[model samples]
Target: MTTSSRLADTPLAGELIRGALEIESTGRGLLPHRLPAWARAQCADGQLHMAESQPSGVRLVFRTRATVVELDTIPTKRVYAGAPPRPDGVYELLVDGRPAGRGSVPGGDTLHLDAATGTAARRPGPAGTLRFGGLPDRMKDVEVWLPHDETTELVALRADAHVEPAPEPDRPVWLHHGSSISHGSNATVPTGIWPARAARLGGVELVNLGFGGGALLDPFTARTIRDTAADLISVKIGVNLVNADLMRSRAFGPAVHGFLDTIRDGHPTTPLLVVSPLYCPIHEDTPGPAAFDLEALAAGEVRFTATGKPDERASGKLTLNVIREELARLVARRAADDPNLHHLDGRRLYGEDDFAELPLPDGLHLDAAAHRRVGERFAALALTGAGPLAARGRRRV
Candidate 1:
């Protein structure tokens, strides 16, 4: 018999296996309802290392034949010094209110959890799906327990579900790169990351290359993008570079061009949008190292300040205005010969008008509502052309 036929005859033989569960926080609490726990564990020593400002919560979940389930509880808001010292203790995973499994978070490992094993490590892999094998056909609830001293934020619960995969299309893929904001920071769910959301909204397949604190115009990253598959693509730049203060204008322009040149080597005519930074008050017109408020840190508040003098424009510091102007000029020069190249102000996606109504609590990342708004705008701008390969053509207004 054919492999497909043979597998069909055996119910579990070829059945789809479950992967890591992904869950995102709705507010300051867990997502509504109990979810199935396929697997769970604790990252004892590394449970405290997180973004400069984040709440403490556990990242736990289950993997099933078709879907991944996650359970997360909000913790008290506080600023952690660093990863806590190693603790030898049992982290519990409960499925349907009963103990399913337990594991220990090893010392010297990163605080981030591995979706597959549910242990925290000193360094985590790039964000992606985690897979698991064997699960009960149906389940409704799950819970995870960490030591009282440990804390975490339930950012995402990701898992593969049994739903039929969307039919594969002949469309060209879109490869994109950005920063933590693009990496889905502060998002409520894995699929809710702005790029993922926008990809879905635009009806295109996407390979998200966003990495937290990793989009510093690194040559390796540029090469990776240049080498990746894509019919058309864009890069959301500026914000992270500015926040990190990685490079000044002298190098920024060439880096941008070089990044494009590398990509063009493979995709000569692909429509590429070079996006500038979005609205950020502190970096609006200044350079870095962006100063952080120690008082805020002591108070468990996270904030950034411009480190440059208000009147000086020659300082090494960079502002959103500077990035935007450079990007527009760069694209204008490139578009003259490269018709497929384009530019978009990130503000067009999330502008001052939106901020006036709903300001970011941290002055950096967008909230769930703001993420949705940006996604919708991105969809309208990039998708909807003759076919997936054809450039939909954005007008320079």
Candidate 2:
């Protein structure tokens, strides 16, 4: 047998990864996980399992002078059973914090899911390479951002020169958790995702906990956040709860309190901001358990619509409006004693005006342009002068 012509023997270490909490060695390569193994072990839900492995905000960061780079990866691309095929996941390259190039590995694996039946099938494929050439020859920091929505298994990293972990930045760390919107639904590129964009504009290091369809207020998730080290923390709540129809008003308040309590156990005084959900007309007053728009799916487009009735509110069924009011009250009451705590109405980031101009194409997640607008708004509102997330003693100069 002839020897294969690939150089991937060196094992990947945690130091090269930025946003992931854990790295697992697989037969193929190293897989980054946003949640710890303990937390992942506690979950049996396939959605959560898949979301945590997607590496939404994770990137391989290093210092190198290589003019050419190659990454061997196995990306598990997703597809709705009847909907049009999704595009391959994109890997973005950044040189010294500036956009340099973008590429995608041709093939790896396919995950076919039936939304109506809530079933999924996985098919394995071969690993592919992502190559970037003609990079600057001078030594500089290099970052390879993994696809935000795809499950990517990194087999090996190859460069023309020596590679080492990039020095940790002195910026404050911003840890954020939310739903698919924050996880980067519909945002074409990884860096275009609102959180990534916001992290850049805000001049902060990001550890994103956003998980698609898996952001329910779970104790294990809260515990994960509690154990993590963050200088500034924010949890965007509401949309996922409403869409899943996971809890009624009665349970939501206590659950929110419990979630915050768990985090406070670890960080008693770190600046904590609780943000509500952005505006979605379908769920504004209507409760959910949102359903796919079958007609749209049949027409080769994926869309979502609320199924719960508006009248359910009388029975403590939660809606976006109900969630906002409750969150506002909870923050106000708690902020009195906890001076560092604050609340942001999510609509402030993307509201009616934004909706009119840039509608959510899938009726739930923001498109690429909307994500950029939201990130800019967030940077201006929370990361600038005297804002809720303003770095202590550092103001916009």
Candidate 3:
């Protein structure tokens, strides 16, 4: 529906955004960025850039009485060469903190990605509108959650009534960083991602720094975590390091220590949890540098496989098992004096038994059901009794 005379453009400012560290006022409208400008400027990798641009847990929150709402956005969607077309990213509507509606824009810019070669050809498209009507005709808190897997540029927000920034949530912020699984992967929607789900279940505000193929233990990322204020902090390590074959055993331990040290600089005594990688059959005992399962891709399916030889572990190559062992040992060694530091075995979230029932379709990322399982497990393990944040007192889920 076209905006009536009473409808006015609601300035999409940083105050309207949650789960993002910065907002960039763009030529089109506004863009929410998970990583700050300085951290982004330090990395030139296309993967990191794209991952951060996809607002995994980001949402636009406001209080309004409008019965009709419209949002215009230009989403940069990725399409793999020769593979089946991916679905349009979804925008989830929450009214008074509950699911109310869901919609997707029809057209937007496209990134034609080559899965095998890791290259993308960009094609610009016109902006599309997502309109929600029949909203409750009274002042209510509304949230429009951006697509978890698409890079979106907010163009406009219009309503028949004035919109104001919603009151900030009175919950402790939970900052989490990890790989594609934490970035949503195949979780289906923005709030369905594991971290988002866990945040809801645990009653905490979420600041997710999970990046697809961009979780390398970079100094800049550590600094970002150090500066961001959070009541609970977690770093899910191992998966990306192994898949990218980024570092060997000798370097991994020191890198992890340094990452934790940087965060402690800002959050001295906050409850910090170091979670190891979730179980992945492909990377359990096999060292990586994982590669695409070309045969599956040829059949129009996406799958990943480990390429490093098992024997390489003897020479310092990292595998899921080795990384888990190292992380557990390091956390145990450090907890001697750092009482607030804790470790959770990643298998506790997704173990071999869970895998049997819900095998990872792509041999890497979790599907929607698996995402729910992991999220629920995380809430039980880290947000409740005997967990790292136990002292904060659990909220009703």
Number of the top-ranking candidate, with lDDT as the measure:
3
CA lDDT of each prediction against the hidden true structure:
0.54, 0.90, 0.91
TM-score for each candidate, following the candidate numbering: 0.62, 0.96, 0.97
What is the C-alpha lDDT profile of model 2 across 4-120, one tens digit per residue? Answer: 343333346889989999988888889999999999999899999999899889999999888888888999989877888888889999999999999988789989898778999
How would you encode candidate 3's per-residue C-alpha lDDT over 115-156 as one tens digit per residue?
668788999888898989899999999999999999999998
Cα RMSD for predicted model 3: 2.3
Residue 68, model 2, lDDT? 80
- Global lDDT for candidate 1? 0.54
Off by over 4 Å in 2: 1-11, 393-397
Indicate the TM-score of model 1: 0.62
RMSD of each: 12.5, 2.7, 2.3
lDDT score, candidate 3: 0.91
Angstrom error of the Cα, residue 86, model 1: value is: 18
